[model samples]
Target: MKKANKLLKEIVVLIFALLFLSPIYIVFANSFKDRGELYESVLALPSSYSFQYYLQAMERMNFISAFGNSLVVTAVSIFFLVILSSMTAWMLARTNNKLSKIIFMSFIATMLIPFQTIMMPLIQFMDQIMRLTNIPMLNTHGGLIFMHIGFNSALSIFLYHGFITTIPKSLEEAATIDGCSKFMLFWKIVLPMLKPITVTVIILNVIQIWNDFLLPSLVLTSPGLRTIPLTTFYFFGQFTIQWNLAMAGLTLTLIPIVIFYLFAQKHIIKGIGEGAIK
Candidate 1:
């Protein structure tokens, strides 16, 4: 009876998984179909698969440039987030002072506030800073990346803090006794030990920053600086509700992140599992 129940649960989960993935399957299938076939039947398999829509999407969206922009933004943002958040979290976790506790709590508090509430104010603030300093804060990749770091750092810091607390401080003491400086100790010992959580942080931030649309839309005005999501949106608009081309564009946009997730999925799962246990 237990085995039967387990089997039944597995079947149920499999059903739900397929149900969740059906939309993606539809998009992938329809991406290959022309407008005529898509209009006739979205659910049906394409009579003949063609890459014409993909080609059209690539050309219309300027996929290469958009992909490069997203890559640069996401890569730079994640790099800084990992370094800064990890160090901040480690300091907060190791220092058991009231101020550290309060600061860590503040970071956690910010996570409760919805991004939508601050979206307008954030844009305005950036604009004001740009006006005051005559700095290029809007319509620039650096500005977008900076915003991503600010918005995403809270969660990353929280995750790193939790993971850091689980690590033994005796190791740091041992390293100190051996004459290792704080900087060298953290770089050689603490940071390397944070591999699992770091992987999790990277995967999470990569997906969030790469697929971000609203933030990028608000920050990046230049057509040349658009990310994949923004480019895909403009492509959809230009195509005027052409579902085939739209789906093709979306499919192309999804390919890179999907590949990244596939590569890092094992580490993500492992990190989360260990974090939960810790």
Candidate 2:
């Protein structure tokens, strides 16, 4: 009976796996075919496998530049996000005051608000600031970074705050008793202890900011500043779809993210597990 049940479970798992993978199979198969072949049979293997679509996408999207821009923006955003959020969360969790409570609650509240509702106002404020300060907040990488910092910081802080509360106050107290300064206490004791949550925050924000389209599109208007998603969009024309090339571009866009996750998969799982342990 146990053997039969195990076989049945295996069959179920295989079926569900195939169901989810069918679309990806179609994308891969169709990407090798020409436009006519794709229209005729989306799922059929190509009559002749060629890397033409990938080559075309690479040239058209200026692959190297797009890859570089994405790397720079994502790295900067993640750097600031991890630092600001982790530190803010540590402070908020350690301190007990009306101000800290209100600030923490405000971060949670901001997360509940939809981005679309604030899009126009955000753009206006940014425009005004640019005009007043001559900082060129619109149509620039810096603008995108600023927006990412604002939008992503609240979420990161919330995650950090939740995980920080699970840490023992005795750790900080012990550090203080040893004549450690407040900054030293955090850098030496708390930051090391918060490694799991920091990893969790990095993984989460990397996925969010890397794949995000709307905000980047709004802020980064120049073709030179285009990230992966925006670069993919250029493959679409007013009337033409270029499905094969589009799929190739999509594949290129997903590869970095996929590689990052594969390498960091263990840390990601451990971080999430530890973060939730409390």
Candidate 3:
């Protein structure tokens, strides 16, 4: 009976996996097809595979510019997030004061609140604050980066704090004995040891920032500055949706992330496992 149940569970899992992946399968299959072939057989392989649609998508989406923008935003935001959140987490983990504990709990509580709840207010504050202080936090790439830092910092800090707690203070004490300054100790010793959590933070933020639609859409008004997701929306209209082009665009958008995951997935898994072991 146990063996039968195990077999049944495997079958169920396989079915669900296929169910989730069917859309991706269809997208890839259709991407190589012309309009007529796509219309005729959305599920079937292309009569003869072609790259014309890929070329067309590249031209229409200004793939280079969009890709560059995404790269810049994702990289910059991740850099700031790692630096700021890791430092904050290290402090929170090391300090036993009541204020630090309270602050940490508040950050955890903030995570429970969905972005949608405060999104409108956030925009208003950015605009108003930028206007008042000349800080330029609206409808700009820099502005978007600032917003991402604020939104993502809490979660990054939480992850880093958890991982850092498991690290022994002996390392820091030894570094101090070697005449290491506080900054030097953190940069050289603590940060290197925090690699597992750093990888976790990078992977999570990359996926989130790369695929984020609402935040970018709300913050960036210029067509030239559109990220891949926002740019992909051009293929759809109120009356007609260009399914072929849209699918092609989506396929293009997924390529970088898929490639990233393929390469870094090892690191991601290793990091999570190491952190979990701690």
Candidate 4:
């Protein structure tokens, strides 16, 4: 009876896994096909695997430029988010006072507010700042990075705050006794110990910023500044969608983050688990 139950559970789990993976399979399999093949058999595996479509899409989309734009935005945003949030969380954790608590709570509270509600106002605010300072906020990569940092900071700080509190003050005390400055102590001792949660924060932000299309669409209007997701729009038009090239382009787009996530995925779980428990 127990064996039969176990077998049934396995079957059910396998069914769900297959259902989840079906879309990926379809996209990956169709990427090598042409329009006729895609139309004739959407689910059928390709007769021949070829890189021609990918090469064509890459040439048309200016894949290198689009890729560089995305890399710059995502990397720069994550860099600031990690450094600033880590420092902020450490300070908040170390300061034992009501004001610190209030500030920390404020960061947490901001996470509750949906971005959609304030997006219009945020754009207006950026425009106002741009007009005032003559800084290019709209139609620029800098603007998109600025927004990514703002939107992702709350969660990164939350994660860091939780994990920072778990760190023993004794370490900092010993470092201080050895003639370490506050900045050096954090850089040398505290930051090194934050590897687990740092990895978690990176994974989260990478996925968020890399995949985000709406905010980029709003902030960046120049064709030259288009990120990977924005470039995917080229494959789409008023009438017809180029499924073959679209699928290939999407496959290329997915490769970087997918490879990144697959490699660092275990760290994500590790970080979250450690942060939660300790």
In candidate 3, position 104 carries an lDDT of 95
Q: State the lDDT of candidate 2 residue by residue for 1-278, as single tens digits.
A: 99999999999999999989788777778778888888898877889988988888888988889889988998999998888888898999988999999999998888889889999998999999988999999998878987898899887887788878876798789879989999998888888887877888888778788888899888888899999878777656521567788777767776787798799989877766654553
Write one digit per residue (lDDT tens) for candidate 4, span 53-135: 89987887878999999999999999999999999999999999999999999989998898899899999999999999999
The superposed Cα distance between candidate 2 and the true structure at residue 221, in angstroms, equals: 1.1
- Candidate 1 lDDT, 1-278, residue by residue in tens: 99999999999999999999998889999998877788899899889888998998899999999999989999999999999999999989988999999999998899889878989999999999999998888999989989999999898988999888877889999999999998998899999999978988887787689889999999999999999989988887788778888888888987987887688788867766664554
- Alpha-carbon RMSD to native, per candidate: 2.8, 2.3, 3.5, 2.7
- Whole-model Cα lDDT of every candidate shown, in order: 0.89, 0.84, 0.85, 0.87
TM-score of each: 0.89, 0.91, 0.88, 0.88
> Which of the numbered candidates is closest to the native, going by highest lDDT?
1
Error of 2 at 174 (Å): 1.7
The most accurate candidate by TM-score is 2
Q: In model 4, how many backbone clashes occur?
A: 0
Q: Using TM-score, rank the candidates from best to worst.
A: 2, 1, 4, 3
Clashes per candidate (backbone, < 3 Å): 0, 0, 0, 0
Give lDDT tens digits, candidate 3, residues 109-222.
998999899899989988899889998788788999988988888778888988888778998998889999989988988999988689988987887898898999899988
After superposition, the stretches of candidate 4 with alpha carbons farther than 4 Å from their true spots are 1-16, 271-278
Evaluate residue 225 in candidate 4 and report its C-alpha lDDT on the 0 to 100 scale. Answer: 94
